[model samples]
Structure formats: C-alpha cells, structure tokens
Target chain A: MTADAAVVVENAEKWFGLNPALANVSLRVHPGEFVALLGRNGAGKSTLLRVVARLVKPNRGRVRIWGVDVARDPERGRERIGLVAHQTYLYPGLTARENLRLHARLHRLEGAGERVAAALTEAGLNLSADRPVRGFSRGMQQRLAIARATLHGPELVLLDEPFTGLDLEAAELLSERLRQWAAAGRTIVMATHNLEQGLEGVTRWVLLDRGRIVTEWTGDSTAVRSRYRQFLKGAPPGAQGRRT
Target chain B: MKGLQKHLGLVALLAMMAALYAIFVLAPVELTMGVVQKIFYFHVSSAWVGFLAIYLVCFCSLRFLRNRDRQWDIRAAAAAEVGAVFLTLNLVSGPIWAKPVWGIWWTWDARLTTTFVLWLIYMGYLMLRRLVDSPEQRARLSAVVSIFGAVNALVVYMANRWWRTQHPQPVIAGGEDSGLHPDMLLALLVTVLAFTLLFFCLWKMGCDLERTRDSVESLRRTAQRHLREVR
Candidate 1:
C-alpha cells in the first residue's frame, strides 16, 4: 500500500436520462487495498466502478487511475486497469484461447500464448481453455473471466460479484487467491451482494444506497464483521442496487 | 443554423433546379428523341450522387474499423442512408426514361441489373447497422460490409460494360466518350455540382444530430438510475 493511491475520484456525477446514477461521489484507494463496495440493487456501485474502468464516461467528475485521468486519456490509463462484470465481455463464439489472445493483443503483450496458457492454468481451466466460451458452465466461465481480467497483470482489478454462482469450495479457493493478489501489492475493488463472503480480507468497507455513499468504514476483522451485520439488518430486503 | 449555413443546402438545391429547368425547358429538344431526352438531366445526376455517397461510405467505414472512431461510423451511416435515397431515384428515373425511349419499362439488361444489385447491397448494409447494438461492433461489422459493397459496386459497374450491356451505356461508346454538346454538358456538370453540395449539407446535419442523440441517451440512462435510487 506504500506505492501510491491506485484510484482517486472527486465530485463525480452521472445521469441516465432524468435520473442521476451517481451524484458527487468520491473516494480514494491506495495500492493493494482490497475494498468491497456494498450496496442494494440500485446503488451506484457498478456505475462508479465502470466510470473508473473507463468503460463509461461520467457526466461531471474527475477519476484518475495511477494518477492518469481516465476520461481525458482512457487508453493510456486503461492499460493499468482490469474489469470483470455481469456480462462475460468475452466473445461467445471464440475459443477461450482465441478470446484471451485477442485481449492480450489489445494489451500489447508480447508473449501472449505462454501468458494465456499460464492464466488458464491459474484459473483451474487449462482443459477447457481451447473450448468456445458458449459451452462453459457458469462457474467455469467466471473462472475464465478472472483469467482474462488478469491476463496482463493489471494493477487495479475491478470485479462485479465475482462469487455470484460459485460453490463454497470454489469461493474459498478464489478468496484465498484474491488475498494473495492483495498481498502481492495489487489493488482489488469488488462489488458484491454476499456480504459474508466479500468481507474476508477486505481492507475497507463502503456502503452505497440509491447511488450515494451512505457510509464508509475501515477496521480489523472483528469490527468489519459487526458493522457488516448491522448494515445488512438495517437495510431493505433485496439485492443491492447497481449503479449504471 | 445561421443564415448562410441554414440556406446553404437550399441554395444548392435551387442551383441544381435552375440547371435542370434550363436543360429540360429552355434548351432545344434533342433532335433524336424530342422532349424525351429531358429525363437524362435528373437521371444522371442522381446516379452520380448515389455512386459518390456509397464510395464515401466505404472509405469512412474502413477508417472507422481501423481507428474505432465514432465519428466515422456516423459518417458511414449518413452516407448509406442518403445514398439509398439517391439510388432509389436513379433506379426509378432510369425506368421512366426507358419506358418511352425503348418502349419497355423493365429489362434484365446488364447495366440495369448491376444497378439493381448495388441497390440491394446498400440496403442490406443499412439493415445490418440497425441490427447491431454496440457502436464499436457496428463500426467493425459495417466496415467489412461496406468494403464488400464497394467491391460489388465496382464489379457491377465493370461487369455491365464487359458483358453485352443490354441497357444503353451513356458515358463511353465505341471505346470513346462521346463528347456531349457544350450546353448539355454544362447543364449536366452544374446539376452534379449542385447535388454534391446538397449531399454535403444534409450529411453534416445528420451526423450532428446523431452525436447529440447518443450523448443524450447515455445521460438519460444515468439519470434514470439516479431517480430510482433516490426513490
């Protein structure tokens, strides 16, 4: 966490038609912080994540990744960031190897074949790496999604509900690897509904409601667990809202 | 939107209309076919603009795919839409002129068939754009399709001439371009110039409006999400 702030946002505002998805939203995360963005279904968490990913532009605001303005210079900044969302973002028709190859080429990686193979192995998907993604099971596809996101060893990793359909064992394995990812000084920001699963190894917890930050808290494991329980008990009964 | 800009397209239209007016009404009727030759003015002008617009679409689409720029996609779409308009007029007017001159409204002649094939391809290109959702994807797919269409346009144009072109070829005859009488060529040149100006004006407006609409739509989606959360 000593290198620098991996992300910084200030007075961000985003609108969809007449509705405001994000209003005056701002936050800063240092390198290696495993932050969890928790919110109800319509919370602006997804929007803010994408705004930082440079996948979507903000109506009014400033967002910088590794000190580079994402909006002003997206390609330059995007080279340092990785994202996995609800959509696989992988071409369904292409084989996993081809999909990874295309993304690798875009990232300008030189040894794409060797790196793609290693990523597939890391995701426990080596056997299926040559198969088209259309045939992959949900959990299997998600693993490949992670592999794709990390293909270039991005500094900032943004995951939206990474554990959505995984079994308990698979979730544990991913959680363990994610902890190792953070320990190695990579920044991780995940948006998820499974509070208990996401709370592990989190350096900070931020709650969003209706596209606005209701609270942000940081602490040791015990405090975060207690606060997470209280937040869930007090919130409305539904999946957290998505920003964007 | 200002004075000169607002009336620019209209001025071009007026100039073309004037040339057409003089060519058809004031100029002496062709000795060969009397008043029937008057259809040649609009007939050739529309075909010229249509061909030029489609070619522009091909060029812009190629750039769009290579650079992944939104502006090129907008230009391609505008060209395709306008080109289709002019091509339809060309197709219809050709028949109108032919029915009286050749005593036939329809023919499977090489020139006519080639034009028809090109019309179909451009129509298909427009349809393909409508089916795509992402701007990036649209640009990629349209670039490939437009290139294919461009090749088709060239093929059709050349194939008609190489084979026994059933439809009469106007530009070249006996391997030499028959020089149009000075008045007739001047009128034709003026009409083509006018149509080119008109196309440019219309294309500018079309591209401007499309970009605005995209920005507004993204804004609207964000606004809707905000409202739901606030509620």
Candidate 2:
C-alpha cells in the first residue's frame, strides 16, 4: 500500500515567521495522476510544490515520495522526484548534452552517454545538443530544463511555472510532452497560473487560496475558471469546500 | 538549551575577570619588553581562537556538504566571521607590540604575510555569500571556499616554524623548558581559556543572528507575495 501511492502529504504546515505558507494541508496523489495546482499569485501554489519536492521543509507533518519519508531520508526521496522550477537548475556554461551528462554522472546512472543522447533526441534538441544553454532561446532552455530534470526517470515530477516565457509553438510542444508523460503513467504535478493552456491531459485541478486547498475538480477545464471566480468572491480566509 | 545559552554569557564574563587579574596582578612584567609585553597574552590567545575558528569552519563545511543540512552552513559562516574579528585583534596587537621592541610598526615577514592572506580568504568567503542570492547556491560555494581556507590556515600556522623570519620563535613548544616564570605561564594559559570561551560566546551570537536573518528574509518574501496578490 505504501509503495502504490506516488506522493502523500499529511497535515503538512509550513510557516515563514508569523506568516503561514501551508496550513494543515493533506493530499494524496496516486500513480499516473496529473494534478494541476491552480490559484492567483501568493496562493502558495509554488510553496506547496516545493514542499513535495523537499526543497523547503514543512514546519509540521509528513511528506512521503514513493513510500520514502522525506524528513527521514531526503536524498533517497529526492532520487524519486524531479523538480522543474521557473529557473532551470542548469549551468548555462555547459551545452545541452553536457548539462544532461553532468547531472547523470552526479546521480551515478548507468549508460550515461546513451541516456544523454536519448534525452536530447526526446526533447527535440538533438541537432543543437552541443550548443551552450545560454545561447539557446528561452523555450529551448526550458525544454532542456525539463529533460534535465527527468534525466534519471523519476517516478514523480513537480513543475513550477514552466510555461511562463514560452512562445505558442514552444508551449504546444511542452504540452504535447506533458501529455506523453502522463499517458506513459508518470505522476505529474504542475503549478501553473494559466488554467486554460496546459489542462489537456491534466486529470485533476486543485485550486489553492492563501495556502489552503479551497476547491478541487476533475475531468475538464470547461467551467473551472468561472467556478473559481465565484469561489474567490465568497472565499474568506480559512474557508474550505472541496469539489470532486 | 535556553538556560545553557544564558549562563554561558555569565561564565564567559567570570573567565575574562580571572584572566584580567592573572595578567595584571599575578604575572610579573618582562625585563626586556616591559609593560608592552602584557598585550602578548591577549595577542597569542586571539591567534589561538582564530585557529580554532578555522578548524570549525572546515569541519562544519564538510558536514554541510555530507549531510545537506542548512544548520552546518550557518555554523561555518558564524565561525568564519568570529575568526576574522579575532584575527584582526591579533594583527593590530602584533604591530603595537613590535613598534617599541623591534623599532618598527610593521614588517612583511612570513608570519605576517601568511596571516594577512588568511584574513583575505575569510573576507572572500563572506563576500561570496553576499553576492549570491540563492541560499543553496551561496551555501555550496562558501563551503568549497571554506575548505580551501582551512588548508591555507594550516600553512599560516606552520610558516613561522618552517621559515626563518623576523617573527619570534615558539615559546611554549620550544625545547624542554619554556624559559618563563611559572606565574607568567599560568597567566597565559588562563588568558587562552578565557579567550576561547569568549570566542564561543560571540560565535553563538553570530549563528543566532544568521538564523534570525534567514527568518526575516523568508517573512519579507511572504509579505511581498501577499502585497502582489492584493494588488
């Protein structure tokens, strides 16, 4: 049962001084579930994603990634999870292939050369694989970042504002990649401000307000925005109502 | 833990008192250097504390890398900062003592040059942290620099022993006898203890300040986020 779930967060509370970031938040994500975290800015969407990534520790409660408790063993937990934040955690001095190769070597993965080659090909940057990341376009950098983050083929992936600076074509390509990853049964959780753009393969939508999960809905993005607007109007602080 | 921290300040004060009494009243003045040699006790004690700080920075830096814990980074940074202040004291006192005895205020001897370089390395470590915005990145870079600083510190300590320079030879570890009055040696030892305790007390304060700075930064970000949301 423990191994079955991809991510489990129970009673997780995070605070920065007196200001609360996550307030008694509990969530469970099954394998292959593509959960899209939605909210206005300062809604703690990024903070919640960071909590699952084990980048920022919670003040109270537990976070388990692939049955491994993050507090007890962060390194092992991190091995199963990949984080792709707004800033690509890549060295701009290195080439696309070199960046991927360096990360693969750091993780001590087998068949590093072939893995780097395959990741570059998969990200559609095979021809420009040797080019330095700094010289690449914004879209190219983000795409390479996505590939670098999933280099070790982690079971769970957390993305924060990945589509922020992408053009239409680049956005389409990233959305297509997301669809493929979801279809392949990888657990994907993305924190996005654009509720409309990347909901094609998203299985669930969870809206957060002031660090609280006020509402969640499944199946499509058809009425999610309108419903969210209505929810926002009546939503006082510490309010809760879950929609399935 | 709170009680222990509170009592540490009191203990450090009492130790400093004993050290002062021993230096001024108990120990006899040197026939050659006269009253100026009294500062030697404080100077040597500060150097000892500074060396201790270097070791701590190295240990904490390695631990931060191995354990991936932020506390270690805070500790290493604290030690380096406190070490720098103590080293400055040593540098200033050395010149003041030298002006009368050696007929010169300063000399670029091996000991002095190496000690100055050691100070520069720590300043670089502190400057690197300030330049970087990301906490994780700052910690990683500073840890590597601190490890290198530790290696340099060993060289600085051994420079006087290895090279024949204007600096005086070792007194405590020089041959069978230290060639000193027993009370003088006793005063020096007590002063070393007092300085060590004082160094630790100041180091703890530095760590606490860093921790508080972290909290303040986090809170500031949270406030910025809320302000934007309100806008």
Candidate 3:
C-alpha cells in the first residue's frame, strides 16, 4: 500500500473447495519493475496474477494497486490495471480495429479512434486491422490482445501466460514491446512457464512453488535459467511440470 | 455445520410431506374444478420459487459485475439452473391442469405465454454459458443475460394485467372479493414455504457440484501437466 508501490498483495490466500490455489502469498512491485513470475504448472502463477488484477479475490488478505485497496475500491483498481490473460478477450466477429475501438471506448480513452489506430500500428496489425479477428492466426490474435491490454495506457500491466501460443518471432516482438513499456516507467508482473523467454528484459525474477515464492533473483538474467532448472529439480515431483 | 445441513434437509422433506397432506386431505375440493384444482397448490408454489430464483440470479449477477468475484458468478449460474428446473415444472404442470380444467392441453394466454418466454430466455442463458470456453467471458456474457431475464420476469408477472387472457386472476392480489378461502390460502402458504425451502436445498447442492467440478478440472489439468513432464 505504499505510495510508490504499483502493486501490493498482502498475505493473500485463495482456495477452491478443498484445493488451495494460493496460500499466504505476498509480493510488491514498484514503478518500472518488470517482474517475470516463473513456476511449473499449477504453482499458482495465474492465480497470483489474477489476484493482482482483482479479477479473483483472495479468501483472506488484501491487494492494492497504485496505493488503492482493490477490495475496498475495485473500480479504481481496475482502471489502473491492464491484464492479458490466457484468452485474447477479443470478439472474434469484430475486426481488429473494431475490437481495439471497443476497448478504447470502454476505457474512456481520449481520441479513441486515433489511439486505436496507433495501437494497431504499434502491434504491427495495421494491415489486417479491417479483417475479422476470427480469420487471424494465433500469433496475430496474440499481438492484438497485447495491443488491447495496453490501449488504455494503464500504469500496471499483468500478463498471464501471454506466450502460450506464440511463435518465436511473435514472442520476440512482444518481449520488445514489454521492454519499451517498462522503459516508460510502467510496472509489469508477468506469469510464464517459459524459463528462457521469461528472462529476457526482465529486471527481476521470482519462482513460485506450491503457492509460495521459493526463490528470487535480481540484476542479471545470465544464470536465471540454470538456477530455475535446479530449483525445479529440487521441487516435489508433483510440482515440477508444464501446463497442459 | 454438516449436522445442521443434514437436519435441515430432513426437516424440509418432512415439511413438504405435511404440506402435501394438507393440500390433498385438509383443503376442501373446489366446487368448479374438483380434483384437478389440487395442482394449483404446488404449481403456483413452484412458479413463485422459480421467479424468486431468477431474481436471485439477477442480484448475484449485479454483485459479480461490481466485484468481479467468481463466487457471485457461481451463485448466479446455480440460481439460474435451479430456476430453470422449477420453471419447467411450472410450465409442465400448467399444461396438465389446463388439460383437465380448460379441456385443452395448452393456450397462449398472457401469463402462460410470458412465463414460457422467460423460460426460453434462461435456457438460452445456460446455452450461452456452455458455448463460451473462457471462464471470464462466460461469466460476463451470462451476467448480462441474467439481468435482461430479470427485467423480463417483471413483464411476465404483469402480463395478465396488461393484456386479456384466459388465465385466472391473481388469487392473493385479486382485490377485496377475489381472495382465496381461508383453508385454501393456508394450504397454498404451506406449499409455498415448503417449495422455498426445497429451492434453497437444490441451489446449495448445485453450487457444491459446480465447485467440485471446477476442482476436478484443475486436478485433471495438473495431472496432464505431470504426464507431459514425464515424457
């Protein structure tokens, strides 16, 4: 809840029936902090990111975005967050341009038409902007999703498994966009299973296991892959795996 | 708490049986409709519970939109499902009673038609949920539909007054001369109370089943992840 902290989760715990999805998880992100959240499948990566986005509330504890308590004032918290989830969150019947325009209008962006056009161009979707999103490939749809998430120019970006269906080239392009966003002082928390891809351009790395932050590294991506591998090996056999 | 739930279930069952006995044995048979009038007790009660369930869906949908909490979405879905069940009973029982009393199986009366439309809307809502793969999208779309259906429920309740129809006027609100007899009203009240309790029990069971289904899906995904890792 600090004034400078872009995102803060305090002692968050979430359970679905008998299964605990997130347990006593707490983390904080500051301005310009690009945190790459790495974990094996079912390690609570997506749940933690959702908690930050306020899409899912924790059974116990609180989350704050940009110094506003999410549980107390969800609308304000939502206004400051841009989330790119597993689904593209776009209408397939609408053209890419139309989709972005809808999001822009929903966010009450100034000069929505111009902002949407700029987003389409920035995402390299200008040429296919008029075509229905249903005709786009997975990679193209993902680029549009990224464009949509950033359309509002939100201060905190939360991405869950953004690279799940992307090609190497598309992923590289997205990484570059993320780097540019981070450079502009936006805080970002990304959840990914890709060890190597997640390390690129990230300022900090966190590894979660069984709903807890087991290890963290800052300032250098050189040894993160090896360290992550060793960490995964030491994790329980049930916890070390890729998402289906 | 578990013991309380079990006892509550038993109490609801016993009360339902008592309500049935009062409807069949205690309440006097209608001079005009004879034995077929017995359906009125449970039919009207089911319709009342059905409308109440849909209202709950609307309430939970609004809560879900405001908070974006999955629990509200779950509750909305469960309510809609239970509402559909009760609505189907109302619709089916209406036709049965009409066949014996009105000498016809069906009619496009104002109340009957609007109630059918309400049923269709909720059925469509359930189908829309099934068609959407993404959980967030499903919840958002269904919430919108639930809100619309709730507004439609008001229309259905008012349809008889707004238009001419063969359906009987409201017995409870039928003005000074139109109220039910004391015995019949007592029977209807008991049936309504029993059905309301039954609605809660079914709604709770539905929510529990949904939660269990979600947990099973998560476990299956985790197992699949483990299998992939082994390869």
lDDT of 2 by residue, B1-231 (tens): 788678777888999999999999999998877999899899889988887898899999999877657788899999999999999999999899888877888776666777788888878988998999867778878999998999987777577546744546533223312598899899999999999989889989999998898789778886775554454
Give lDDT for model 3: 0.84
> What's the TM for model 2?
0.71
Q: Could you give candidate 2's per-residue lDDT for residues A1-244 as a string of tens digits?
A: 7677889999888753345778988888999999999888878989898888788878788999888999899989888888877788888898998899989988889999999999999888998999888899988888898899999998788889878877787788778878888999999999998866777888888888878887789876777767766666553453323221
Chain B TM-score for all candidates, comma-separated: 0.86, 0.88, 0.88
lDDT of 3 by residue, A107-126 (tens): 88899988999999888898
Contacts from the true interface found in each model, as a fraction, amount to 0.00, 0.00, 0.05
Q: Higher DockQ: candidate 1 or 2?
A: 2
- Provide the fnat value for model 1, as a fraction from 0 to 1: 0.00
The CA lDDT at B2 in model 2 is 80
What would the TM-scores of all predictions be? Answer: 0.64, 0.71, 0.69
Question: Residue B54 in candidate 3 has what lDDT?
Answer: 86
CAPRI classification of candidate 1:
incorrect
Query: In candidate 1, what are the lDDT values of residues A59-170, reduced to their tens digit?
Result: 6789988888887899988898888666667888998899999999999998988999898888888888889999988777777777888899898889888777676765
lDDT winner between 1 and 3, please give it: 3
For candidate 2, the share of real interface contacts preserved is: 0.00
After TM-score superposition, the amount by which residue A21's alpha carbon in candidate 2 deviates from its true location, in angstroms, is 6.4
What's the i-RMS for candidate 1 in angstroms? 9.5
